[model samples]
Each structure stands twice: as C-alpha cells, then as structure tokens.
Target: MLPRVLAIAGSDSGGGAGIQADIKTITLLGAYAATAVTAITVQNSLGVAAVHLVPPDIVAAQVRAVLTDIGADAVKIGMLGHDATIDAVADALADFAGPVVLDPVMVAKGGAFLLAPEAVGLLSARLLPMAAVVTPNVPELEALAGTQVEDEADLLLAAQELLESGARAVLAKGGHLPGDGDEVVDWLASHEGNRRFASPRMATRHTHGTGCTLASAVAAGLAKGLPLERAVAEARAYVAGALAHAPGLGAGHGPLGHGWTLASG
Candidate 1:
C-alpha cells in the first residue's frame, strides 16, 4: 500500500503553498495525499490579498471525517488561522497514533499574517506538544525560541530549548542565513542529539512554499516508515532539487518545481 499522508492546512489559491503544495509534495514523494483546508486565501505567487477562515467546528469535522475514515499514516499541519482552529485541530488529533509534522506558519513570504497573534500562544502550548517534528524558518524560530538564532551555537541552543517545550524534535531552517553563500544549513534538534543538513541553496525567487513542501515531504517519508533523521535529510534534498528546477510562474516569487520528481520518474 502507498503511504497515506494527510495535510491539515490552509488553501493557497495560487497552488504554490498550503494544501496545494502539500498535495504536490506528498504525491511526488510516492505517498497518497489527503487534505482538510482550514482557511482559504486569495493569493498567488505575488502575495496574499485576503483570507477567509473556515469555522473551527467545521475544521474539526473535516479532520475527524478524514482521520476516522480514510485514516492517515502521518499528518502535516500548517496555517491554523485562529485560536479556535488550533483547539479544533488539537482536539481532533488527540488520539492520532501516527507521526505529526507541524509547520508553524505564522507569516507569509510577502509579510502577511497567516496565523493570528492570539492564536500563536494557543498553538505553542497545545499543538507544539503534539507534533513529532516542528519545522520553522529563522524568523519563526526567533519568535518561538525568544532569541535570535544567528549562528550555529544560537541555532542549537534555541532549537534544543524549543524541543524541550514538548515537540520530539525541531528543524530550525537556516535558509535565511546571511552572507549570500551558495549553501544553506538546517539544524535538527532532538532529545537524542543534533543533526546538521547542508545543501546548496538554489538562487531563485521561486521559494514560495518551501516550508510547507519540506514538512509534507518529511511527513511522506515518515509515513513510509523512514526514521526521523533520514526523513528530514530526504526532505532537504528533495526541496533543493525542487528549487533548482522551479518552473517560473506569476509576476513575483514563482513556485518550486514540485513536479520534478514525477517528471524524472
């Protein structure tokens, strides 16, 4: 049977992020993809213009409908728009036995808030505890860890502290690190130890859904029974390839080449 990975997130009307990105990444990684959209955004590669949130109960209902019936081997979570939505997700997944990868999507690439400020506290206290792995970009990391992760030491320290908050592990992405280097480094911190993954950063503006794609790819790997470290490594490599081969679209930042793996095969 193909690994089943479910994405519970918002809808990116542009097909570059959120549920669209999750579906593309999961399917390309050889996993069955299912989704429960928590919100819908009028967005494209350029940026978000408006967002309409689905009711919390409705979100819970969607999650329950999928988890109890079709079921999921692993879950990728992103952009729960409100506090109630966060609670709804937490309530619905309380008994999930499979791995959960949470992408704490706070801000969008064009500087829009995907998550409410009040909802951030609820998510940190509730959902973070439930996640098997939490993927956060540098700014998101600083927000969660309450300290700037500017260097390797800061990266490990903040990640370790955040992991202790309840998540089994945290992937602190270093893609936004400065110096215009050709490579990007990500630090994975867990109870066991820390792992560093380095890859050449493809210089492109088509990195719209990288965080969502990476999390979903890791979810697919976990659904296939790959270990956590291996899953993250595979996700990083996959994202790099996607970046390298992005099919430039829209007037602004284009979407990654999510279909590359499928085309290669």
Candidate 2:
C-alpha cells in the first residue's frame, strides 16, 4: 500500500512552498498526501504580501477529521502563523502514532516573517516536544536555540540542544553559511549520533521553498517506513537534485523543480 502522509501547514498562493510544496513532495515520492491548512499566504517568489490565519478550532477539526478516518502514516507541519494554531495542532496530534516532521518556518524566502514572535514560544515548548524530527534552517535555529551558529561545530551543538529540549532529532541546515566554497553541508543530529550530508553548492538564486520541500520529503520517507537516518539521507539527495534542476520561474528566488524525473528510469 502507498504510505499516507498529512501536511498541517499554510497555503502558499504562489504554489512554491507551504501546503503546495508538501503536496508536491509527498506525491512525487509515491505517497498519498492529505492537508489541513493553518493559514493562507498571499505570496510569490519575490515575497509574502499578507497572511490570513485560519481559526484554531477549525484547524483542529481538520486534523481530527483526517486522523479519525484516513489515518496518516506521518505528518509534516509548516508555516504555523499563530500561537493558538500551534496549540490546536499540538493538541490534535497528542496521540498520533506516526512520525511528525516539523519545519520551523519562521521566515519566507524574501525575509518576511511567517511565524509571529509569540508563536515561537508555543512552538518550542509544545510542538517541538512532539516532533519526531525538527528541521530548522540557520535563522530558525538561532531563534529556537537563542544563539548564533558560527560553524559546523556550533550547528551540531545547536542540534544537540534542540534535541535536549525535546525534539527526537534535528536537522540544522547549512544553506545560509557564507562562503564561495565548492560544497554545502547540512548537519543531522539525533539521539543516535551526528552525521552530515554534503552537496556541491549550486550557484542558483532560485531556492524558494527548499525548507518546506526537505521536511516533506523526510516525512514521505518516514511514512514509507524508512529509518530516520536513511530518510534524511534520501531527502537530502532529493532536495539537491531539485535545486540543481530548478525550472527558472520567477525573477527573484525561484522554486525547485520538485517534479524533476531521473534519467535512469
């Protein structure tokens, strides 16, 4: 049977990230995708113009409806816009029997804040504890851990701290690390140990929705029963390929070609 995965996230009208990215990632990886939209964002490749949050109760109802019937094998959460929504989602998934991939989506590709400052506290205290794995890019990691990550060593330490704070695992992405080097490295820290995934840095500015895509891909692997480390390994490869073959769309930071097919097949 195909693995079933649910996404609790906001809707990106631009279709590059949030619910749109989750759906694309899950479907492309041979999983069934379900959704409960937490907010609606008026956004594009350039920036986010506005965000309309869904009622907390309504969001909970959607999650309940999906869990009671379809029963997801894994859940991916992104772009939660408020504290109430985060609380509602936490409550809804309290007894979930599947892995949860939390993408701490604090800001948009254009540097617009997607998560409110108040919501961060709720997310760290409640949602982070429940996540099977939390994926935080540089800025999000800094916000959650309350410290700057200057190098790979700091990234590992931050991930360890995040795990100590209750996340089962953490992926501290290194995309924001400055340098004109040949490789980009992402640190994966878990209860088991720390490992890294490295890829040659592509010089493309079209990296919108990368965080959303990576988290959802991890969720897809977990839904299909891959172990955490293996799931992350596959997800990283997928994201790299997506970035390498991005379909040059919008003028500003464009989106990955999530549907890009392998030539071997």
The residue pairs in collision within model 1 are none
Candidate 1, lDDT over the whole model: 0.91
lDDT of 2 at 136: 96
- Displacement of residue 91 (Cα, Å) in model 2 is 0.6
Worst 10 residues of 2 by lDDT: 256-265
Candidate 2 lDDT over 167-213, as tens digits, reads: 88999998887667788889888998888888888889989899999
> What are the RMSD figures for all models against the true structure?
1.0, 1.2
Candidate 1 Cα errors over 4 Å, as ranges: none
